[model samples]
Target: MSSVDIPRTYGALLIGALFASILSGAVAVQSLIYQKMYPRDPRSIKLLVFLIWSLDTFHTGLIWGSLWKHFITDYGFSAEIDHIPWTLALSIVFTAVLTFSVHCFFANRIYMLSKRSWILTIPIVLLAVLRLISAAGTTVEMMILQSFSNFRHEVRWLFTLGLALSSGVDILITVSLFYLLQSSRTEGGRFNGVIDSLILYTFETGSITSAATVVSMICWIVAPTNLIFMGLHFVISKLYANSLLVTLNTRKNLRNRNRSVSGSGSPNNNQALILEARRAQGQNSATDSAFHVKSTEV
Candidate 1:
């Protein structure tokens, strides 16, 4: 990479890291709020928030790792680190973490909606095994970095497989949530609307992020530009931000609904009683004020 390419590369990575960090912070705040307000199992919501934070953390780590590999390595203009391994180790770990995180998130969603404990556990175990296999087979001290061509091809294939599985699980969860919301409407349509909207936003963001990853893989295999990889990071950040927003909004709407329901009695009786009480109070106050004023004048 030339001097010009260097600035562009670092700049893009920095922007992506910042975006993902902001999103992670938002998810953290929303998670805390949800834990306090919602009566649902706190563990599930906490796990979801943690997974999201992990995704963003891994993403930012990847960007920094790439910067170190490219700029600090001997081939680059700076060349500060002549022989750092730039271990595929961190990359491998990042992929594994992200893969497991996705699996956990989907499993939690499935468990939440269907209450099927066994449904998600098996696949999660399988995914964990796959990730471990993908990470193993390296020597303790230093592993030789493959040629860019080979590395790109291998990473693309592995990412595609992992992404496909994650997206498939997400789609299943999305469909389940849709049906769950449809079947479980509450009075006033308030809770149901919030649930449906949250689900819809999650589905849309997840689908688009997965699609972008597919496109990025294609671009990697065909053209092999750093820009496409950077774009993938940005898209992932956007997905994280949108998912955090949805979760926050869902919690807010649920809290508001609960407050409204708790404050109001049965609709008809509450309204009639409120009206009659107001009318009687108004008449008595007027009569007293007039009597007092006349007595003072006399």
Candidate 2:
């Protein structure tokens, strides 16, 4: 490796390591908070959030480990020492699996949010199948190491297809989410706020993942630079952290709203009810003085 490449490689590796730590920590913290706040739905779509973060944690760790062995260890980048075939195979398989899980998670969220499964489910399933086929092809080529160069060519094609399909899925999900949010506003329901929050969280997470995948694809096209992978890793790590924070805030807000709604039914029920009704009416009035004050604060 060139002198420039050495620092770049290690720097990328360190970033991936940091990302791994952050993702892992966020998963732990979020899991505990969700468990405490919503024990009944522990196995709900939120669990998939933890699953995705866990996959990212492992993925980043694997990238970091490979970089460490290549840059820090005395072992040269021989195929055997690098475990090139095994690494390639594992990367393809695990990445496909992760993508499938993500699609499923999104589909589940859409279903829970809108009670509309068929809309998202069909496309997600199709894309997941494509990803699995691409993964299998790449893994097969890696297992037969004698055709490594040919395998790289095949893998490149698979990566390109995977990228396109994944991007399409993300775009569709984003549009669907926005549509759901718009519909929710006029069609008020019990879980409207929760649904909106989930949709926003899922859309943002998908955007981050798609962006990382784009960077990874570029690295594949140009050169196998650790910097690209590291950048993607860090992006995902930050995405997970931000997602957890958003979820926590949403949960807190929901709790506060519920409390506000419930607290008005106490011994001072008559006065509290009247006050709340006034507040509600004022909330809907364009000329309400409090509305202006709250809007200014916002």
Candidate 3:
């Protein structure tokens, strides 16, 4: 057996717990902002927000508990480090649940935005469910095996598949939303800015979660002996939670902008914007014309 570097193995976990803690704070703040900004949001949505926050809080506690078991409880016994802690096993399940919830939420959005296209949303949902199942299987195996080395040898493929499915679902959702928003663009260029903003948000939200999943998968594959992969995995659920919260909170701002544009019933501001754009174009045209004149003279 390779000698375990306590700092590398355990320090990774400590750093991951710190990151999870910070992201959890962001989740709480975003949830508060969402409540204040959209008080009339559907009861279902409010409940979802509360549930995600609660799960995140509990997930943090579990990470800490696992840390305590490793560092404090088994202070003198290094052999116990190999065994999977109950808190850590449960944390994996919680992460799977959180990821599944967020995935479902985005899947529903894609369904609505795609005009109730079951064809598009069904595949994403299926993939998400499969990911959840994989995660559950991983937890069960972890408990039964009770050792990281054994779990890695027996069912590392399950964990890898879950991460791949998660990344795939996120990409699918982002592309679907981006395509829908792009197609909805106004030829008149009035709502193009709004559509562009939506596109950016879609890309950003998808990228964050996808990137984390991919990195975690890489760590698991490349360095199975270390806890770094497990550490990265700890942050994945937090990223998903914050991504959902940010997406939900920003809807109010986007909707209000759209409403203001509609309610004013006046094209003056739009016209001014158009005129300003034209002015810039005209200046560029004149500069080009002058350059050509000088070239001809020379």
Candidate 4:
């Protein structure tokens, strides 16, 4: 380790640890609020919420455990981070699972919104699956190699590839979702408000997740020996979960917007959004005998 880089490395890891804890707390609180808001959600949606919160909380603990084991238990071992701690390796698995869970959820939404277009969603799903597998592979390699330098020297390509694919999946999901919503927008109708709000919300979430992935990869590639990249990566899955939950949790807001759109006689847009609004809320009150075709035709 270069003497000149000691402070930089320490600063990165310390800041990353701090940020991860804060974001984890934020997501934990958000998850609780989501639970309160959507007490009637379907089993599948509830299970997803459980999984996201479980993994986020566990990984946050893993970060602190690794830090304590390294900085306190094994202090003076090295001036710079070259070795990968076992807890950190474990956290990688959680990160991959958390990230893939979020990806699959969005892909499912994309699949539905794209009117069940297999072509549109299958590639995105495949990329997401590949990323998870690659991320798991990275964890295994880190465990076996046990040294950050060795991991980077031998399998950095895998690390970089996983990050790239993660970003790709996020971007694809965002664009597909926005495109579907945009296609549903009528040029002169008040319904545009709902669609526009959804668009902006989707844009904000997608951009944040994708940008975090890119910055993490850039830092790792630029300074593989430094912990700066880990700081960005640590909080990334929380961001994904938060964005998804926030969108889900705000279905009431979407409903309120849709109700106003309905007064304008935009039958098509109102119908489509109502169906979506109901689905988001996990409400199936439309019944098994309704003649209205499910509005996923968007």
Q: Top model by lDDT, which number?
A: 3
Give the residue spans of candidate 4 off by over 4 A.
Answer: 2-4, 264-275, 279-298
How many clashes would you count in candidate 4? 0
Clashes of each: 0, 0, 0, 0
lDDT of 3: 0.79
Query: If ranked by lDDT, best first, what sequence of candidates would result?
Result: 3, 4, 2, 1
Model 2 lDDT tens row, 68-142: 555556346433232343543455566666666656555554554455558666776687678667766666666
lDDT of 1 by residue, 87-148 (tens): 43344345445545554554555454444556544565565556445444221122454443
- Candidate 3 residues lying further than 4 Å off, grouped into runs, are 1-3, 263-298
In model 4, the worst 10-residue window by lDDT is 286-295
For model 2, the local distance difference test gives: 0.52
Stretches off by above 4 angstroms in model 2 are 1-10, 42-61, 72-88, 146-151, 187-203, 224-227, 230-249, 258-298
- Sort all candidates by TM-score, best to worst: 4, 3, 2, 1
Assess every candidate by TM-score: 0.59, 0.65, 0.86, 0.90
lDDT of 3 by residue, 1-298 (tens): 2556667988999999999889988998998997887665556777889999999999999999999999999887877777799899989889999999999988877765665789989999999999999889888999999998888888889889989999999999888887877776645755567667778988998999999999999999998877898889889999999988887776656656655655554544433111010011333432100000010110
For candidate 1, the 10 contiguous residues with the lowest summed lDDT are 289-298
Shift of residue 290 alpha carbon in model 4, Å? 20
RMSD, each candidate, Å? 14.6, 9.9, 11.8, 3.8
